[model samples]
Target: MKVLVVEDERDISDSICQYLANEEFLCEAAYDYHSAMEKIHLYEYVCIILDITLPNGSGLDILKQLKDMQKAEGVIIISARNSLDDKIAGLKSGADDYLVKPFHLPELSARVAAIIRRRLFEGKNYITLDKLVLDIFKKTLKLDDIDIPLTRKEYELLLYFISNKNKVVTKESIVEHLWGSEMDLADSYNFIYSHIKNLRKKLIQAGSPDYIKVVYGMGYKFSIH
Candidate 1:
């Protein structure tokens, strides 16, 4: 899952990013309101860790912007403020949860996972599609009760494809989703082709019907029928 940590405190932001990254989440940081706004407008994330007090503006404004734009990303307010008004306001503004400062990283991670499950996976720990079962928390895939071992990248690719099943996904979008802004420095898209090929081969070997379909020059689509 992709998460955006919108915090002005360098230490807090870094710690959150590090912890979430270790938990197998793709994390990006925005240290101030301006940067946070830029990232919120530019990309899609499964969750947003927002600090209410920012350098240039309040994080509540960011929440309002998200609502205005009708973005579905889950928001979690993590701030030092412990006032009941703040908590109620944040929750009323569409934040999925709130965490007071000096909190445990594990708790934050759990909350993030819960919000992602609720928003993206319909509150389920696993996603079921025909004979395939994807364990979101464990990051494992099984085909007809048989485990299908996959590399980290392969697993992420498969999850991305399955999440957008039957819809054409562009190669650029795939690269951005997996590698984020770093894809801009990539010289070619050969890596995407390689990963997709490997994922397809493994799925087919695991007694699954071919679900990945190349869309000629466009990209690829995952469909069951």
Candidate 2:
């Protein structure tokens, strides 16, 4: 999943980013309201960890904007303010959950996962697409009831394809989703080719259908055709 962390605290933002990355999530950080606004306008995230207090603007305003615009992404409010009024206001402003500051990283991670499940997967812990199944909580993939071993990248690729099943996903989108901004410095898209090849081979070997398609110059697509 893709996440946006909007926090002014550099240490807190970096720590959250690192932990989210380790969980196989694409994370982007914004230190202030302007940066967060810019990012929200440019890309779509699965979730946003918003700080109610910001240097120039109130996090409540962001939440209100999201609510007014009816964005599909989930929002989790993290603030030092611990009051029923604050929590109620956040929820009233479309925040999915409220997390107080100085909390454990594990709890935050768990809340993020819960919100993602509710928003994207209909609150299901496992997702099944055709013959392939993904056990989200366990981080396991199964084909026809048999476990399929996959590298972290391979698993991420599979999940990405499944999430956008039957759609033509561009190679650039795939690259950006996987490597984020680093794709700009890469010399070639050969790495994408390698990962796709390995993932296809493994899925086929596991008795799963070949759903990924190449679109030549434009990009790749994740479709059953």
lDDT of 1: 0.90
Using lDDT as the measure, the top candidate is 1
* Runs off by more than 4 Å, candidate 2: 68-70, 185-188, 216-218
Minimum summed lDDT over a 10-residue window in model 1 is located at: 179-188
Error of 2 at 93 (Å): 1.2
Over 63-122, each residue of candidate 2 has an lDDT whose tens digit, in order, gives 877777778889999999999999999998889999998988888989999998887688
| Tens digits of per-residue lDDT for model 1, 95-154 | 999999989999999999999888767899998888999998898999888999998889
Q: What value does the lDDT take at residue 22 in candidate 2? A: 86
Q: What is the lDDT of candidate 2?
A: 0.85
What's the lDDT for residue 72 in model 2?
A: 82
lDDT against the true structure, per candidate, is 0.90, 0.85
